[model samples]
Target chain A: MKDVYKSSMLYDFYGELLTEHQKEIYEDFILNDYSLGEIAQERGISRQGVHDMVKRCDRILNGYEEKLHLVERFSKTKEDVRRICQLADSDINQKNISEIKMIAQEILDNY
Target chain B: MKDVYKSSMLYDFYGELLTEHQKEIYEDFILNDYSLGEIAQERGISRQGVHDMVKRCDRILNGYEEKLHLVERFSKTKEDVRRICQLADSDINQKNISEIKMIAQEILDNY
Candidate 1:
């Protein structure tokens, strides 16, 4: 995924946990496509301060993702569901049903 | 589920993100079944302090679950997978396959 897109997705998932100040700066810089100098001027902080805050936000968001893995599991579950759909579209067979059950069990086991 | 079991599940999922002090105190009080006074004396803190800390930890962990819904989704997904397994165990037919596919699609849509 693109850097900004990934950041935004992380932000969407975990942004509420961030402080109000961090949220404002992160939105302006990453989501709104504002320049460092522009956000710095608006927030009455130095450009380096704004830059540091954005980097800190990224680290914090990534840290949450690493620990929680909610996003990762979601992607994997979606893929598994898609695979099940494909299996279902094929000819109905006992083996096919077994495979579907196996996939579902895998999904359950993962949690 | 039992209170301790539920707390342990939350701790297992999100406890590592907590401070070391929080983890130790929580493990003692919740997992080891230590009383507030016992924990407080062990840590050289007041019973009220230990009680406050445990309550705070509960709030924090519950807050994380509220926002992220990882635990909630895990339970729901497990139930869905069990439903899929049951559907699979029935007679193999077009209706059964369609139901399986529909369940899979529901899982995908949820994510």
Candidate 2:
């Protein structure tokens, strides 16, 4: 989950719970990689305002993550899927493949 | 990116910044989903000790994420990869497939 799109996915999953302005700025700055100054100009706000908004939105998102741990759970599931895919890509034995598939299914079921 | 494996990946990528005890307990509790009592007993610490270590480790992990944003970047890349894979799986046009491939390559280059 240390990848860019994964970050955006986490944000997208939980960011909707934030304020509308928070969501907008976060999507632009974080997901789209818009500069703080660019976001400020686009939103007709000061650069500091954009920065503060992003910081606040980050706090909100991370706060939810700490308490709820859904993002953590989701990330672990993704890692398991990647590991299974990797195993399958390699020449794994049938028993190993079945185990990987079972783990994948368990993860999918939980999600 | 909100998947469990993704979360563990993020933790694995950055958890090293924490204390050894912190890392051990966190991996077991979060990644392996060991109970607090279980981790505490295994580590020869009190239940409260395990709880505190996990909380502290969580703060440390989230703190790094806030300041550095590496996990965020990685998560976004994973999402882009998944999106491209999905598009490839579907009957996307040549132009779109080329576009997706280009995007995937760009992502791979960054990682």
Candidate 3:
């Protein structure tokens, strides 16, 4: 259901590793929301050809994320930061707040 | 310089992506410090074969790091944390300590 969203995130993390042509086509489809027909015309390829290339790029990016897990770990760290921020702003005890802040800071420092 | 050390660090970041064969051979060479001839005998391959495979693994791991820079960024963040700890311990102003802590915390959270 969210293949495109996940692909784009993976692209953001590993797009530099892709070939130049792959970047252009992937960006057009994922970032620019270009239709397959439009990409085909722009790249001087058939619509089916464009689709295949896009699929190839998807596999490439997904493989990188599978090995790296950069996005998943990043999301978890972000959630931790959010929780710490909320705790800091709440009417919590001062000692508890500092303890929570220290833990959150440690999580970030480790990453 | 320090190719073995660098290779081991890269392996720590991306070794899971390699094939089973690659993992075994690479571990023997880099982690176990086995000689090329020893790995070749243990794996039932030639010395030259072991050498080539180890070199290939190096290239593959280095390629991943080049694109992701996970280790480079991790090292930088670690340095920031070190500075924060040092500043906190030093006879610095409380205002300066909190400011440095906030900046370092932000860097970790973003990462």
**Candidate maximizing DockQ:** 1
- Model 3 lDDT tens row, A1-111: 337777877887788888999899989999899999999998899999989888999898888778877678665655654554454444445453455446555764555
- Model 3: what TM-score? 0.72
DockQ for model 1 equals: 0.66
What TM-score do all the candidates reach, one by one? Answer: 0.74, 0.45, 0.72
**What ranking emerges by lDDT with the best candidate at the front?**
1, 3, 2
Q: Please, what are the lDDT tens digits per residue for candidate 1 over residues B1-111?
A: 228977887887788778999999999999999989899999999999998899899988988888776777767877877888888888888998898888878887775
DockQ scores of all models, one per candidate = 0.66, 0.03, 0.21
* Order of models, best DockQ first: 1, 3, 2
Worst 10 residues of 2 chain B by lDDT: B84-93
| Candidate 2 CAPRI classification by DockQ | incorrect
Candidate 3: stretches off by over 4 Å: A1-5, A82-111, B1-5, B35-38, B44-48, B81-111
Q: For model 3, which pairs clash? A: none
Model 2 Cα lDDT, one tens digit per residue, A1-111? 224575575585566567677888888988888888999899899999998888787777776666556556656755655554454444535554455546544553453
Best by lDDT: 1
lDDT of 2 by residue, B1-111 (tens): 124575576685566566677777888988888888998888899999888887787777776667546667656755655554454345535554455546544553453
**Residue runs of model 2 more than 4 Å from their true location after superposition:** A1-111, B1-7, B105-111
State the lDDT at B10 in candidate 1: 88
Using TM-score as the measure, the top candidate is: 1
